[model samples]
Target chain A: EPEVTQTPSHQVTQMGQEVILRCVPISNHLYFYWYRQILGQKVEFLVSFYNNEISEKSEIFDDQFSVERPDGSNFTLKIRSTKLEDSAMYFCASRPDSNQPQHFGDGTRLSIL
Target chain B: AQTVTQSQPEMSVQEAETVTLSCTYDTSENNYYLFWYKQPPSRQMILVIRQEAYKQQNATENRFSVNFQKAAKSFSLKISDSQLGDTAMYFCAFMRLMNYGGSQGNLIFGKGTKLSVKP
Candidate 1:
């Protein structure tokens, strides 16, 4: 019942500015992941992290995107220069082990103006 | 690469009725996992049910059950005695099993089917 929580449920930023989406995964979870869902589109994987390093990333996770576990509990995704196309609902997920299913946060709706 | 497909874009069922959402995937790996996630108006992804490829028996959780055909690469979710709360967008996802030292599991999701339970 421990859920992943995300802050700033709604974020609006200028096109060229930087933005950071924060997530607090389940306390005991080991793997963390980021996913994007454009309006009316399928959810797409952005990146996955484990053991304090990135395990894999999709093409959408380019030079402008980076993720870090700044502390033990917080996982943050920073976009250096936001583009209009970057506007989407970003979801953070975590799981306790290999065979366990990933639990998702409520999601942060990022809107670029 | 693995891909999950949900052919039905939208569906509706009367309250207390039953409905099934279809899903199919294209994958070469023998060992993997399939799942159904429900995203209500809140846009929160909630796990509905999971089916392991190695398991021959289908997974059932109360009113929610899965009809998994491993050979056909088909996995579908059946909701019995549906209610208004069941009105949500259902997504079918696929994930390859993780190796001890390999990459972490990442879900490949379908476009999703919006189910509306009308009272």
Candidate 2:
């Protein structure tokens, strides 16, 4: 199975600091997504991007959240001024196309101290 | 709004035995997809199996298969001849088919069921 690769398997940052989580999706995939799973909680969708723009986003993707497919290969999720509650495992996923299954990355464990 | 429910929070099965994880969803869309993903201690969400609503035949991958009841809105995963490595948190998810922006694959997941394959 093709895998989505995420950078910095784990990250520790202080509250109020910004954090950037990077992902390298499968080359042939056309759509990308970002999701978060707080410890002991279900995974929640944050946003989905395609064609260099956000196609859809959940309420969790507020003003502090942003995503970019910088340089056409790297997809990044940036959280500005993180909070303690921001601590969670952020997962990146990409799909070949519509109606196809989306594959996930190993995830980046973000710990906001 | 669509929601997935995994009634069983935790289930235990002996190695070499079979265990089934329950998942029910609420959706009105006719065309959609249901999936089962396994997350081990590593936190990697691995796709186990998926079923398309249009297909009446169940989807199977080796020992992992789903009992998809579209009319009942139930999609349950049955792990046959389970192994120790099968111990993990299993999540059920739902996605609506996109008429446009198909690439924006948004998934709504269930709370998840923790499966323990005891050796």
Across all models, the iRMS values in order are 2.0, 2.0
Q: Evaluated with lDDT, which candidate comes out highest?
A: 1
Q: Report the poorest 10 consecutive residues by lDDT, candidate 1 chain B.
A: B96-105
lDDT agreement with native, every candidate: 0.96, 0.94
| Each candidate: RMSD | 1.1, 1.2
What digit string (tens of lDDT, one per residue) describes model 1 on residues B1-119?
89899999999999999999999999998888999999999999999999989899999999999999999999999999999999999999999985562337899999999999999
Q: Runs in model 2 with CA error above 4 Å?
A: B100-103
Assess every candidate by TM-score. 0.98, 0.97
Best candidate (score: DockQ): 2
Residue-wise C-alpha lDDT for candidate 1, range A84-104, written one tens digit per residue = 999999999999988899999
Give the fraction of reference interface contacts each candidate recovers: 0.82, 0.95
Docking category of candidate 1: medium
Residue B38 in model 2: lDDT: 97
